[model samples]
Target: MTVRPAWLLPKGQTREDTRLAPVGTWAPDGEIRTRDGVVPGGQPFAATGVAAMQLQIGVGRAAVQGTTAQGAYPIAVDAPETLNFTDGNAQFARIDSVILRVYDGLFDESEQPLARVEIVEGEATATPTAPTLPPCSLRLWDVTVPAGASAGVGGIDWGSALADRRRYTTAVGGIIPTGWGLSFAGAYDGQYRDADGVLERWNATDATWETYRAPEPPVETITGGLSVASGWSLSSFDARRRAGVVQFLGMFARTGATLPANPNIGDTLVATLPAGWRPIVLLEALCSNGYGFGAAAVGGDGKITIRSWAGGNNVSGIEKDTNVRISAAFVQ
Candidate 1:
């Protein structure tokens, strides 16, 4: 039964047969499951305060991967598992870890695929540090035992003494838990993950994770301050801005009781383009005076001035009754 199927167990199959591959299939291998950690969801292996020096771990499931020879092992805690810590060192504090461990007889000379929850006591020193996890084990929590602490006399404070070491994994392509990215390298470019509350994508070239932001609309319409110069009134006009470019389309007609026989080449048409709508350098556009062609210039000061006018017969001035049409675009 070296190459056994993971599912559809036959009637005569033994316990060892299930451990061969059924458990691994139930929890597939991938970036998420192949890593040693709790199978996230529903308070898996939650540790709670119990009597002094005692902690109770709620039922949970986890995956543990050992050497290639030992392969992977899955653990399930159907009932609560209570762990008792050794009496605190009389002179200094110590850190102890609750771990889910797999012991394979083929590799450990013990029961084949034996899984259990156990405590690995830490060394007591002036600055106590947690014990190192052995191979084929997943740490669930770290408990700090202060000096002189005992079950009944000066018991441990569950809140301050317990440090959660549980990490989580999900099905492939699923949103992994926060902090997962900090420990594992991204699988590919454009790989996405939830970083705390923000969505981020991996950048393979830069070897970094960048925040994802939605694209914004590019063009905006200019709504106000398109006033015409004295003796001129707007007929139809539109002004829009995109990036650093500003565009305009409009018709201006002469007004007032007295009108010049012809508009001067230096006469102003638009008084100002308003702040932020001005150009960095002077820009010119060819215009029409209904009867002849001319040119207009927009200065950095926001004024639009008539630069030239080829009135009928190649004249330099525009007829007073002729309407002016200006269509232009410039970059600020």
Candidate 2:
């Protein structure tokens, strides 16, 4: 009696394209066993959808079986089931929609990217869960572990080789491009690195991180004076007008000083102009003693010159020891 080959039989035909579609059974020992033996599951794997979920490669293509051809393993997302290993260790179980857990080298829980991403399906859905990164530090580059940050709320390590700290250049041909290093710069708040790598803060007023300055204060009042002769009360004096290197000054005085009987045309007064100031213009002058108003001027030497005047000319005697007012504009 001769026996036919398994490929020639109906039961064997199903196993013929195991490369295209591998069929296996879940063992009570939590192992996925084929007619030959058990196969191990390779991970960092990705799958999606609700019930009858499949391990997808690109988007929604069914997985083809082969040593070379990529294939997605099929599994039910609603059920609590563990895909077992050949060593009899169950990888995991009770995995439902969007609740996939990741394991590290020691088989410890590393991350749950799927579970964290489920918030995107929340009642008031927000932005989709995704990765975020900043592009610069002491330098500009794609941020990553050991370079940009280790984990959440972590600081960037500038010493890491992955960060680019040098002045960014397009090619070795000395072609410099605008905004060559950093990316998505506006997405961040607070402090950031400028194009020159200088740490700077955002100026809300100008909407830039460039140079900014506060406004200057308003112009102020400036006052100065000199001592009056003995018995002369220099009550109040003010300079209200401006000229070329000069200030217009007005003064009120109670006088007691002696005066020349017949004052000369260029008679100097007791009061002196401040340094760097000279009386160039005289507007008015008045005396309480009814003395004639005198013509006043400031010389370039800052000397107050009270010239004998035609009217109110009491310089001989009536002007002596009398109340007087003087007004003159000075120039520096």
TM-scores for every candidate against the unseen true structure: 0.58, 0.27
For candidate 2, give the lDDT: 0.32
TM-score of 2: 0.27
Cα lDDT for residue 290, candidate 1: 61
Count clashing residue pairs per candidate: 0, 8
What is candidate 1's CA lDDT for residue 133? 88
lDDT score, residue 200, model 1?
A: 80
lDDT of 1 by residue, 66-176 (tens): 776555665667678888888988999999999888776667766454577899999988999999988788888989999989986967889899888887655546555
For candidate 1, list the clashing residue pairs, or say none: none
Over 4 Å off, model 1: 1-33, 179-181, 214-332
- lDDT tens digits, residues 60-108, model 2? 1011111111111221122222221111012211111122211122222
List ranges where model 2 is wrong by over 4 Å.
1-220, 241-245, 252-254, 257-266, 279-291, 311-321
Least accurate stretch of 10 residues (summed lDDT) in model 1? 1-10
